[model samples]
Target: MRYTSEHKQATRQRIIEAAGRRFKQDGIDGSGVATLMKDAGLTNGAFYAHFASKDDLVANVVADQLREQRASFDSTPSGRAGVEEFVRRYLSVEHRDSPESGCPSAALLDEIVRCTQATKEAFTDGALGVIDEISAGLAPGDPQSVRAQVIAAFALMIGTLQLARALADQQLADQILEQGVQNTLALLPAEDRG
Candidate 1:
């Protein structure tokens, strides 16, 4: 029987959501096509009906993740303490340990570095949008300078979280998160500056 458009769209969304989770949990390259299908509650053969290739799915997932990131960036308050809370939460041990449900930037950093142009473009665009959001939270300054500081904050947050997650020592990992939070908070504009 032919499926309805709504059914197809729902199924497609299921595949994208499942694939996004898997891609974040395991690097995109590490997640097999069959596993993605299974996770989406469909057989491997049905994959082609939705996505042309895993790369296509990756692009879709990256786009979706970017939308989510944008919402998060826009919703978060621009106050100094709000920025502190963001840094603390972002660099927390919970965020560090939960790649599957955590920040896509940190979760997919390695695979993204060598990804296709489509993937890179989508990622870059989303990231720049987020950087703009970050800039909004900073004290009023030259746009270029604010963007530069925002970029540094982002680099430190993702890099520190990645390293913290990679370490075998739990204490050191926790310490990394704490230090990362502190450092990230320091990157933000102070109340006096704000």
Candidate 2:
């Protein structure tokens, strides 16, 4: 039985969503195609029907995850308040504890740096879109001027979350998250801190 285009698209989306969660939880290299398929409630053979290769799926997942992250940013009030909210949420205990549902950059940046060219390009494009969204909120007057600052702040946020998640000490981890939020917020200009 042939599936309709919509069915195919929906199935593809399901696979991407499942893969995104698995990849974030269990790095891209750690997640086998069979496991990813199983996560999506499909057989290993069904993988090729949706993706040319695992690399292809990785690229798709990265793009999809980043788009979801971007949407969260879009939902916030557009200005310093939005950036503040973003920093707080990003460095929170909830986000730190939930790698599968949290920011892709925080969960997968290390792996992303080693992915295939296509996957890297997908990450680059998606990351740029996310950066642009945050930059606009940081500097509605001239986002370009604060683009570097935004990028630095975002990197700090990603790194801080990663470190917090890696620590065996719960108290240190919580401290990291608190300090991460403050340090990230400091990157913003005083004028934009409103």
lDDT per residue for candidate 2 within 1-194, as digits (tens), equals: 99999999999999999999999899988999989999999999889998999989999999999999998898998788878998899999999999999999989999988989988898999889998889888787788888898889988999999999999999999999999999998997656622
Please give the CA lDDT of all the candidate structures.
0.82, 0.90
Candidate 1: worst-modelled 10 consecutive residues by lDDT: 136-145
* Candidate 2 clash pair list: none
Q: Per-prediction TM-score, please?
A: 0.89, 0.96
Which parts of model 1 are misplaced by more than 4 Å? 139-145, 192-194
Model 1 residue 187 CA deviation (Å) reads 1.6
Best by TM-score, which number?
Answer: 2
The lDDT leader among the candidates is 2
